[model samples]
Every structure is written in C-alpha cells, then in structure tokens.
Target: MDSGDILASLGVNGAAAAAHALSLPAEAYGNDAQLEVLWAMKAYNHAEVYFNLISSVEPTFLKLTKSDDMIYSKFREDFPDMDIKTLDPELLKSADAKEKWRPFCNQFEGIVEDFNYGTLLRLDCQKDYTEENTIFATRIQFFAIEIARNREGYNDVVHSARAKAKQQQDQC
Candidate 1:
C-alpha cells in the first residue's frame, strides 16, 4: 500500500541494506497513538494529492475521450449486462481486460494498472456515477464515471472550488 513495501518487493537486499543503514535500533511497531497518527497523516496526504491529481487531469482525458455519450455508449457496448454487485469482486477484478475489454483498456493505455484500482466513494449516491457513492472499481471505472461527469458538466461542483481559489489568489 506504501512505498516501503514497494521498495522491499522490488529489491529485498537493497531495501534491507537501506533500512539497516537508515533505521534506528530494531523495534516492533506498536499500535499506539504515534503509530495511529503517522498512518492517519499518510492516508490523508495521499488521498488529498490523489484526488487533486485526478481532478486536474480530468480536462485532458475529456479531450482525449471525446463526448460523454461516446464514453457511456462504449461502456454499454462493452458490458451490456453489468451487475457488479451480483458478481464476484475478486473474479471481476482479475479478469483480463486486454483482450475482452480492449476498447476500454485502449482508452487508458499504459497509464492504468491493477494496483491503482481500489474502493472509491461517489458523493451523490442517487445515480450510478454521481460522485456520491463508493465502490471497489478499477482505474477504468474511475475514468468512466469521472469522464462522464466532465463531459456532462457535472464536475463544475469540483471545478468551481478551484476557480474560487484562483480568484482569491488573483485578488491577493
């Protein structure tokens, strides 16, 4: 979930050596207030950066993908019978999209990966992609809904906040 595990996985010997050199005396991590604070801060920072990055990238992807109708139509065309709640999440998550879902995968191309996929909350739970619900989904799913909002003009809710910040900066 974090860089430490990634470093360890990529090269155990190097990671071990680095940790040995940089780390303090061996000590087991305790489930204490300090540990909790560290985790909370890390999670919040990561999420804030990630959400903003996604928000900023929305325009570029919208330009690339074209119309909102095209995005949704492509979605429907790919999975005419999508009932994710009924299906097995593990099975669906690992199913190869390269061959079967080529169109969708092609849209994202090299940028997306299985690891980036995780649970996301949609704020407006009334509709499917209303930014009001959280569900476990792939990177493509995030793109689909976000692109849907971008093209359909629903993202002004997010954009307006940015505009306000810019306005404040300009005034200052």
Candidate 2:
C-alpha cells in the first residue's frame, strides 16, 4: 500500500496528522518512504507479540514496563471513571482525554522507551487486533489502557476464551 493508504489504515488522516500523532516533524514522513515502512513493520510486530501474549497467558501477571506499579497507580488515579474492560476509542481520542493524558504521558518520559511515539492500541480488551478495533495512541497511553485491562481481568478473560475456542476446534 502507498503511504496514504498505510496512514489511513493506521487511523492517521495524513502525513501531517501522522507526524502530529507521533510528535515528529511532518517533513520527517514523506521524505523517507522506507521509514514509514519500518514504522508499519514495528507496529505489526508489536501487535503480534501482544496478541500472542494475551492469548497464551494471563495478562495481569505480565509487566509491560519496569515501573508497572507506579504507572498503574497513576493510570487509576487519572482515569478513575474509565471503563477499561470496554474501552471506547472515541472516549480515548476525545479532546478531554487528550488534554488529561498529555501530562500523564509526559510523567513517564524516561521510564518508557519512545514514550510519546505513536502505537497501535486495541480498542476492545476481549478482541484481537483488527483494523476496525485499533486506534493510534501514544506508547504510554497504550501502556496505561492495556495495564488497566490486564489488571482488571479483561485480558485474562480473553485468554480463557481463546483457549476454550482452540480446544473446541481441536475436538471438532
């Protein structure tokens, strides 16, 4: 796919918007086609790893970053009303959420790698990654939502459901 298609598929409207989402210069995008491909690859790899992780084991036992406790506490404090098990992309992408998330994201600058970099976030905890079910979010935002999902038992439910489905398939 061309860059425009790729950007659209990733939920980015344009190079300018994609750059803004990633907190990078707009010029940094169109000038390097290879860079965009690399970014797509990285996103796909991350999605694959996370899908496998949640499917294979209990996500609550998984630690996303070294500062899991601190991050989880802050996430809960900042988003007390967030229904992590049924996370809505519209709510997360809203102006209010963005305004609140900036500071929360900035606080983990050094603790998380590429903390502000754009990443693909699954909108629903019970579903695997899919174009319609994904949205672009900062890495820290992904961590916060996912950490909440894991801790709240949504991901464990996903794991159990997938396992049961696989067992049924084997029996069939």
Candidate 3:
C-alpha cells in the first residue's frame, strides 16, 4: 500500500534497489551535473581511503602532499606571466573566499562546473569527526582542504587511532 509495498508489488527488488534508488534527491534523479558530482565524490572517497592508508604507513606522504593548485608554481617558470598567486587557497569558505576563487574555478571549468555550492556532506574531520567540531564544506572546497590537510599532517591523528585500534585487537 505504501511506497515499499508498491515497489515489492511491482516486482522490483524492493530492499536492494530501493536502498540505492530512493536515497537520491529528486533533483539528482537525472541531472547530469548532480550525477557527475556523485561520480566524482565516489572517486574522491576511494582516494581518501588510499590517502589515509598510505599516509598512515608513511608519514612522509603527509609531509610531502600538496594541493593540485600548488603545482602552479612549477608551471610559472615556463610561463613567466602566469601568476601562481591566482590559485585558490588550500581551504575555502565564506562568500569572500568564493568571490576570490572565481578565476581559479574558471581555469578548471571543464572539471568543476557545478559550483552549485549549497550542498553539505558528513565527513571525518582530519582530527575528529564529532558532530560538534565538524564543519560543513562545499564539494570543491573539500578537494582543496583535504589535499592540504594530508600534506600538512592534519591527518597524523589517524595514525594514532589506527595504532590504538591495532593494540586493542591484538589484546583481544
């Protein structure tokens, strides 16, 4: 009688298909921009897993990590008029940050088009993922900050957590 029963009656794998299908926003049902963001988020999520794993094992990766924008400096040597300062900061938020960010985003328009900007996602803060301390960030901003965080050692706390977890499991 309800949506679940209707789905079942229609012979859809109600539980399995419903789990993924109904979870999307009505706007995201077919919007290419939303779909691309979702797909990019999936790849970014996988990259985060590997980023955490590799940085945990070798802190040097954390020591050496750099945002995509950071490579701009090297490019400047060949193109003298190319100012690397035009790149966005590693962490971005607030209206002013967005205003200052237009040029950088323009350069990557093919890749970062949606700039829709209002959406929020629950995520692990580099130090702690507590709801109280958590901050909401836009999708593109997340890419910038995370790249900087991993490089700047903001994720070093994860190593300690992993160590503590291993010790507990070993004792068990």
Candidate 4:
C-alpha cells in the first residue's frame, strides 16, 4: 500500500499526530528526506502561530518557556550590541553568525529540549512571517532572539497594531 493509503487509514487526527511526531528526527529515522520536509512544514506553522500570538498580545509579558529570564539574560550578555529588531537575514544565516551563536546555544544543551532542532525564525520582529522574512535556525537560537526582541520592546508595535485593528472591527 502507498504511504498516503497508510496515512488515510489512520484518519485525520492520526495523520496530524503522525506529522507532528515525524517533525523531529530520531536516530532510527536517519535523515529521511520526507521527514525533513515534514519537519520544515511543521516548523513553519509553529513560527506562524507564534507570530500571531505575539501580535495579538503584549509580547513582553509572554513567557515562551520556564527559562525565559535565563535565556534573555544570556542572549543579552552574548550579543550585547546585536540589534535583533532590525536583524538582517544574511547575517543570521552567515558562517560568522553560526560561529558566534554556537557557544550561546550550547549553554542550554541540557536545559532545553530539542535545543538543536531546526526551526523557522523571523528576520524582523516588525514583519509577519513570509518567504522573504524567515530563516532557518536552531530552536535555541530562535528562542534567544525572540526573547530578546520581546523583552526589549521591539514587539510592542505588533500588539498596538493588533489592538487598533480589533478596535476598528468592534466599532464597525
């Protein structure tokens, strides 16, 4: 039977669970191409949901994980002058960026689950997720950048804009 048939037999909820489970690579999986694509799509949707959440609320008060304060502190210490609000995509994907980020990411090796898992991150806090605005990075890196962006008030505009839109909708 085809893979589609197998998935179809599982039903919609089962298929969704399967996709989420396959999104993270395991030792036994051994880098399957299909699994990688599934992971990418799941990561993209995760990012989209995160962006929507932050835009609708005050990002500064949101705690993504239990270690929010610790993550933000380390990020600030490691990247003192880095302007995450205006972060450039090329800079984030550059070899230099990886080299610099490795040490920061490594600090949370045991503390953060799936710290090295691939994830999608937005280049600018002011922009919505789009093909041109997103980049691939490790989960820890995404959290660090986003935590810093939130704490630094870069994401405040999203909340204000969303509130304005809601107010207009309510009036109409």
Candidate 5:
C-alpha cells in the first residue's frame, strides 16, 4: 500500500482506540495524564494523515483536485469506527491540504527563529532553567522536526542535480 493508505489505516485505528478509551466510565477515564496520552495519539494520527496527503504536492495545490468519491471512500474506510457525524463538512472541504499546510510551515519557521532568540536569552541568564523552559523548548523541538522535513525537500532537489552532474562527469 501507499503511504496514504498506511496513514489512513493508522488514523482509523487511532480513532477506534480513542473512542474505546473515551467510552470507559468516568472513574475509569483515569487521570489527566491518560487523557493527554490519548489526545497525543489522536494528534499524531491526524498529522500523519494530513502530511501523507499533502507533503509531496506543490504549494497551493488543492485536495479537491482529487476525486471526491475517492477522498470520501478513503476517509470512510479509514475512519469507519469513529463518530464522523461531528466532523465539519465545510472544514473538510476547505482543508485543501497543500494550501493549508503552508501555515504550518510558516509556524515552523517562526519557531526556529524564536529558538534563536531563546538561545540569546539563555546566554544572558545567570542560572540554567532549561527544564523549567518546557513551553519554548517543546515548541523548538516540534518546529525543529518541521524544519528538518522542509529542508529534506530542498535537499532532494539539490541531491538530484548533484547526481545528474556526477553522471555527466563520469560520461566525460
């Protein structure tokens, strides 16, 4: 199966798991930590699906370019166990994955710049409070992954050109 199919399957499984976890009795719902874990899993699953759908496409590309029947079929098959009734049709329609992803990329760029600011502040601070700086640190960590992924696209282009040049050199 393609990456999209794999991601869709994972998303479906994640939704099912989250629903099952949520169905537990109030007392059985456990603590905030458990809830956080469930939410995190859901977030990861959604992100994987979104990224798989959009990552390779050009900027400003629209998911609507794909057939609606196909998109709906994938969504239904992947999330069969979930309560999709609450899903926003408008949001889904507007979620042209490629175009929407630009904001995420921009956020990632901003976070990296913010990290540079943090580094400057850290140098001026008398005592280390790295552990206490969870918010900014977490932002940095997450954005770093985004930045790396973004860089990978550019690297692929450059690498392809280098390979082509090397091939020509070898021919000479």
Candidate 6:
C-alpha cells in the first residue's frame, strides 16, 4: 500500500498519536539540537517500523547498523555539556513540553515503539509475497502514517519556535 493507504488505515487516532509524538516546546522547536533529537527519534522509529514490516514478508533480512548515530552526533553538537552517560527519566518527565502534553507524550512514544520494530520486522519476513512490492508498500505506509500523525504537531512547534526565535533575534 501507499502512504495514503497507510494513513487512511491509521485513521484519526493514529494521526493524533504521531502529532503528539513530534510536538515540542515553542522555545525549543527550532533549536538545531532539539530538531535533531526529534528527527533522530522519528527516524529511529521509522526504521524500526520498516524493519519489522519487511521482516514479516522476508525472515532472512537481519541487518542492524548505527543509522541513528547521526542524530546522536547532532544532539551532542547542540548540547556539548549535556551528560550522555545516562538518561534521566525525571528529565523527560519534568520537561516543560511534556508537562504541556500531559499523558499524550507517553502514549505517543508507546505507540511508536510498538509499531516501529515489531511490525516492520514481521512484515519483512513474510514468505508469501514479493519483497520489492512489500518494502515499497511498507515504506510508503510508514512515511504517510508518520507524516499525517505528526504534521500538525510539527507545524505548531515550528511556528511557535520561529516566533520565539524572531523575538530573540530582535533582542540580539
């Protein structure tokens, strides 16, 4: 199926889930570091979904690389002083944006994790169909679902961030 089909399948709830996942604070949305983190998280999620879906159609495909390393590097560049050794759950929980999102962030993350790895892998290993078609369908579907879900949240974040950035720029 194409991206549209995937989105159509996800319906409104799926779209909401994606939006909630990508939503960021107005101040942080435009920060390169923040964008990198969000994109990295998004890419990782997409890769997982793609992998699972492909595996479902073809069980022999098992290749794992540090594809998400770029995103990590970006984060490091943006926040060089940040401690990388540990992830503080409290930090995520205490985040201003998270507070704004309330329980939605947790729910969104859960859904992304669930669909990304397992589903993609399962789809990849399917032995009953053509690999090329399946992969294409999976990619499109995943992309569409993600885009539809996150577009609104992404836009909101970006717009708010841009406005804040402009104010800061004027101050400078």
Q: Among these predicted structures, which one has the highest TM-score?
A: 4
lDDT of each: 0.49, 0.80, 0.46, 0.83, 0.37, 0.37
lDDT of 2 by residue, 69-152 (tens): 888999999888888776777667789878888899999988888888777888777787898888888888888889888888
Clashes of each: 12, 0, 0, 0, 0, 33
Question: Cα miss at 40, model 4 (Å)?
Answer: 1.8
Highest-lDDT candidate? 4
Using TM-score as the yardstick, the better of models 2 and 6 is: 2
TM-score for candidate 1 = 0.40
Error of 4 at 124 (Å): 1.5
Q: Across residues 1-172, which tens digit of lDDT does each residue of candidate 5 receive?
A: 5434544665878657767775555566556885655544444444444344333443123233223333334333433442321222332224573254344334434323332212101111112223332122123322332223232242233234546666899999
Query: What does candidate 1's lDDT look like per residue over 1-172, in tens digits?
Result: 7655655564878656544533333245544674443434333444455456545554434443334465566765776665432333333455674346555756755444432333353444222332234444555665555555555556545555666777899999
lDDT, candidate 4, 100-158, per-residue tens: 88888999989988888888888877888888878888899899999888888999988
TM for candidate 3 is 0.45
How high is the lDDT of residue 78 in model 1?
Answer: 77
Sliding window of 10 residues with minimal summed lDDT for model 3? 82-91
- What is the per-residue lDDT of model 3 for residues 14-127, given as tens digits with 9 covering 90 to 100? 445544653566575766674454444443444456456643564325422233555233223323342222222233455775575555545544454333343332244344
RMSD of each: 10.6, 6.9, 9.3, 4.1, 17.8, 21.1
Off by over 4 Å in 1: 1-50, 54-71, 76-112, 125-134
Model 2 clash pairs are: none
Off by over 4 Å in 5: 1-17, 20-30, 64-172
The better candidate by lDDT, 1 or 2, is 2
